[model samples]
Target: MLGICVCLFAVFTHVLSQEAEEPVFYTCTEGYEYDRVREQCRDIDECALLDDACKGGMQCINHFGGYLCLPKSAVIYISKEGEQVPLPAVPAVPVVPAVPAVPPSQPQVPRSSGNQGVSLSSRTIRCAPGYTADEQNLCRDIDECATGRHTCGPEQTCYNTRGSYTCQCPPGYQKNGDHCVDRDECALTHYCMHRCVNTQGSYYCECNAGHKLASNNHSCVDVNECDVENPCQHHCYNLIGSFLCQCEQGYELAQDTVSCQDIDECSFSSYMCQYQCINSPGSYACECPEGYQLQGNRVCQDINECETGTHNCQDDEMCWNYYGGFRCYPRNPCEAPYAKTSENRCICRSQAECQGLPPSIVYKYMSIQADRTVPADIFQIQATNMYANTHNTFRIKAGNEAGEFFLRRSSNVSAMLVLTKPLSGPREYVIDLEMVTHHLTMNYRSSSLLRLTIIVGPYAF
Candidate 1:
């Protein structure tokens, strides 16, 4: 009996083993499922097999007939630690390789790919780091000129080199030289003056020392000194490179250059006038004194004023003016009463008392001061204008023998006079001078020298 029960248990165990190896499927409304792999039953996520597997955002499900497939939205995920966890973001669906259209009999789906082909798992593009199609396309080189990818500034030129281009100045420019070197105008001696200013490679023209350049041309001109402050003492004229100074007339240059002096015309005869001319710095003149008219001989002479009527005498008198002297006449109407008829006194009947008179009783005494000097041609006046009386009958006594004599005279007017003749023999002198009326007289003697009175009278003072 114990052997029979053991044999039945072996058969049951064999049947269960066969069920775990081969699982059975049911229709839409199926029976309860069996799973013998772990000797326990498990539920299925059946929404994956539903007709409309999910809503737009969730999958729909149907469970075995009474076990309906439900949407995944109704379920919540749980962590291994038993805490509720938020649902993770849905992963983007992987794009599969596009298949070409096949005929009706051909297999619609592809077989599993072999490992020999390139796999997405090994490529960075498949690892979620995606690539752009433009980058993958064939890359063209960056043309500097075409794309305007140049570093050169305006007015500069650019040249292309491999991988990069270089900046450059235009023609006639050098690397070390001024990139835009101006042409060196001063290098050639064409328009330069004393010096040249080099700017870059070019220069401007200028004048040299003591010279000025003309606006029209490159020629240099000499500075004109005469036009300015006048370097010359006189007229100034400009020359090519210099000027000339000339001393003007009426002046002479001194040792020092600055000043001019008036030349003494009198010192030299060149510009002197006639008649003892005198010269001034710029002119000349003549000089003459009084009492002397300019004569033909150019000298002063004692005037014979009496003959010339120059003496101030009475018009009624016949004046016999002489050289250096004069004589006067009252028109002698009567002869000398004392004169003898025949070497003897005339005894006229009515004039008996006047007869026998000694011939012309003479005045006795005379004295004078006579030392004198006179001026000449170039000298002053008043020294040469005078006269001496010679015709008067004033007698001198031989007995007196006077060493001195005096002179006096009277006419229509009185006079005061200075002597011109030099005194010689006379030293002691005395004189009595008087006239009864218009006939004035002077009496003098050798003893009267101590009181020789030169009496003055009325005249043109």
Candidate 2:
């Protein structure tokens, strides 16, 4: 009886082990369904399958074996009557059927067990808003921008997030409640260096006179007026916002500021030139009369024709230099009773012809400028032949009626002719300077005379 009982326990254990080895079948979760073609479980797009999945202006999002309802608008708006209109409240996360935690590579297969199969059950889960289950049963973001289900207006842009979507105004616009409005950028910031002009959603800059807009469109640069069109006739200077006109050294700026006028420098003073003043376009010139030359800018100096060898004096004649002119005289000037003995001396050949006259005469010529100083010693006379025991006295015998000149004896044989008063000319004078010699020990008396000619010039230099 003990052997039979042990064999019966062994048979029962083998039968139970065979029954436990049979394959078990699995059913997809509430939000998932099995794909007959791919032979795998996939998430059910409940939002696409059910038209009435969401209500009250809510957007429908699909998950694994489930669906969600979310508020269509993310922001609030104002009504036409200025009343605030609130958006719908966000719905709670929808219940999602839990997917089976089966290995994808080795899925549970159904095995025949007397025309029936063992099955595994599934439960439900919940996911956050804006998330949907993919084919792999993983949560992902929905592309609201790509889909027409987004509630963003025409002026707004939509962007998708991991679990939600957002609506915003486009560039150059700002959100005002639920509407988009143009933003005044000019009023918000100092964007322009000069004048600022606001446009639709943007702004531009404008410059004042004599300024130009820079490349940046917001800065102003100075425009050089002189470089474009120079209005000055002579010189142009460009300033910060304007230009200046200037004239040359000898010119003056006209009233129009564009023309340069000549300055009459000669009219300012009569002493501009010693002889004559000539006005030119931009300057003045100093001119001299004939036989004269300009010394400096204003003074006139006489030309020495004799010294410069410009005179036409003959070889037999002597040239006398005067201011602005010259004269020629015979080399021997003595005449009539006076006979030429030397270049400047003459003697009376006949005592009867020289009676009551000096025995000898000497000729001398000299020139001086006009306005000579008074009391000037002009000429010196010395006896050529000397005699012993003789005393001499000198005097201006002729040309002394005007009291212009006097003779003073320095030694026994020499004398000087001095001018006592100033004289001005272009004038000439002839004076007889007589020297009377008396023999101190003998009863003899003699007289000699010097014929001097003085020519005065017209100018000082």
Candidate 3:
């Protein structure tokens, strides 16, 4: 049984060998021939059969009867004829499946088509989550009065719209102190046509009938009634805003302060009477009182009843006016001076008031009275046109009356009067003096005014 099995196996092996083996023949179309049939018929790696057909980093991959050029990872053998080259082990490579090409005929989607499946929506903008339609539409201004966001500032009026609100002021409220508050136009100053009546946002006024508003709106001025018609009978006086009447000429203002009346001047001489005057109502006439008549002057003058001896004066005397009465005096005693320099003048000799001063027909200022008891400054007197006849001696006296005046006992060389004395107010004094009796007669005359002034000065009886 073992031998039979062996023979069958041998036969099987022989058949397989014959089927696989082929004679090695170099099939060259020309020239080269192989001596070894068996060797030539065997497949050879190009690196092996043709002698190193691949360069470095390349390998020969044996196929059915031919070989393929592969990368170095496929090389299993190395050559000696090339050298005893070291054989780099060929690593087993895994087979990769082929990728199938997509057919160009398949339909492609168009870019213009709206994105449908698998397209994300564009991001949306939304109001804060708590907000609603009442707040805004498309995120616009919101009406707080409607949206419940309204909180008006103090004293401010809030008006709401669809999306917003306005802060305003009610009537008479003005923006002041950076806020809306009650306004007082009169705060600056009271401006009114007449009486200022303050109202909401404005003012009114009450004016008298005779006055009107000034352009500045604060003053009430007089209405010109005279331009329209004359309401006054006589003179019209214009007050601040009204008129009054007053009488003119002979007329007088009546009991009514603004009315007129006619004057009756005959009560105290007529209005035109020069000699007499009167007060009357509104008008007056010119007329004479008793004992007088109209003259070239408007005056009622007295007639001289005595020119015809209604009363008579002495032949040498004259009549003159003594008020409404008559008087007579010696005309020769009052004759006008012959020379112009002596007009209205008279001459007289008077006494003196001091020692060393002579009595003459001259003027002097004062007279001596008592001693230092009466004071000296008040005792000054001038001796007029002195230094006449040599050897003439004089004496002066001072007293309350001319009966006995004081004598100037001495003269002070330094002062006119002692410093211990000062002048008093006006007082009466008397002067008395006498010229020293002498043989030679000397004539001494002061100025004519002095001559008359002595008469006007203090006199002794």
Candidate 4:
């Protein structure tokens, strides 16, 4: 058996050498060729060889025995050999088998005796259309797509099949008549939540104002302006496609609505504070002037230096309180013809040894705030000695130069002193009030005097 196998190999080698010496014929498919070194059919790379294999910005993808044209942005899968494969949109193509070599039609007969003659049968093999034979005498499928032998147009892709090829549109395109055209995906389907922009052979989503594109690239969501921009000067609130700003207490929004401004509480009204109104950044304060204190939030009250023991009056001086200040006066405000009877009063007892003078002289002291209302009744006087059926009259005997005071009679024996005009001070006034009584039945008259001192303070609290 081994010797017979060696004899058959030598005969095969001899046949191969004879075939080489003659014209050897190799039948290969359109996209394949017989490799002389490997003695087999191999695929052709049309993409590498043809410069215009893929037109219109399409990418050329080489496959087994064929090639594909796809959009530049199309998604593709990779095979184990690191070759690109078409997406599902493109129809799958079957791999074509390798071609085989064809044997010669006639064989040489060996010259030998009848007993040594080997009868060999002659077999003829032929390939069908779109198929070819390789060195192994096997029929292989043709790749007409890779060889540009298909009927597909420039806008279409060619897929190779067993012994055949089919034409189809690439991704992002649809077949229209004899050509492929771009499909308007944005107009056909509502895939974007906000807005859709149609591109060449594709579509994309967009977002409106105050909205942002979601991760899916087809939906929109709120942008949260407060967190992103922080437009408010003090506080900010975000809403749908808008935002709002707010200020803290004692402040208000400015004209721009994004900034905060101080609200001048003092300018609203004059009565906001009794003394003075002070404005701050976020609030206001009420303040009192010298010698006064704030009573409440907006009122000022006098600081009574005498009552509060904050005065510097000496032992011989008496402390007096006025609206917003204090003053010191002599403990005894009496002059000649008057004797001290109390801390604020004096009286004359003997009346100058019974001469032509009033019988008694009294002293009184009082203080008032500056700018006191006019026509104010300040003091009163009455006859100390009155007889039966007596008529009496009162008068400001002195110190009436500015017409600041006048005496009005209330009854037959009593009268009141009135201030006729407003006075501002740090000032002092002295007046002598006198009264005279007449006994109508006896036809005799008696007189007396009352000394009054008025001190006016500096301010009104």
Task: Name the candidate that leads on lDDT.
Answer: 4
Minimal lDDT window, size 10, model 2: 6-15
1 versus 3: better TM-score goes to: 3
The reply for model 4, stretches above 4 Å from the true place, is 1-144, 160-170, 175-181, 349-357, 378-387
- Per-candidate total of colliding backbone pairs: 28, 2, 23, 6
lDDT at 4, model 2: 10
lDDT, candidate 4, 305-383, per-residue tens: 9999999999999887877788888887766665677665566576454477666667677878788888899877776
Give the C-alpha lDDT of model 4: 0.71
lDDT of 2 by residue, 1-461 (tens): 01111011100000011133332223443445444345545665756655555433357755334555555544433242445554334333333323333333344333434323222222111234554546544334567778666888987877554345567676456778888887776776566787888776556789988888888787788888888988789999998777889999889999898799999999898888888899999989999977788987988888889899999999989999877677787898888798998889999989898889898889898887778888899899998879999988988889778898888889999998888888887788989999999998997899999999998876654
Tens digits of per-residue lDDT for model 1, 1-461: 01111011111111011112221111111222223332222233334323333322233333322223223435534343545554333322212222232222231222443332123353211110111112322112344754678766665666543234456654323344424554454563344545556566334456665567666344577777667557766656676666655466667766765456777766776324323555566555553232223344333333455656676667655454322234454333224553323321122233455444332221222222223333111111111112232122222222123433333233322322224334432233223322221122334211100112222111111
Q: Please provide, for model 3 over 141-247, each residue's C-alpha lDDT reduced to its tens digit, 9 standing for 90 to 100.
A: 35576556766676676655322455666555666655776566555334565577666665555568778876656568887765555666776767667777767
Q: Flag clash pairs in model 2.
A: 31-64, 31-65
RMSD of each: 38.1, 19.5, 41.6, 13.5
C-alpha lDDT of candidate 1 relative to the true structure: 0.35
Best by TM-score: 4
* Candidates ranked by TM-score: 4, 2, 3, 1
The TM-score obtained by model 4 is 0.63
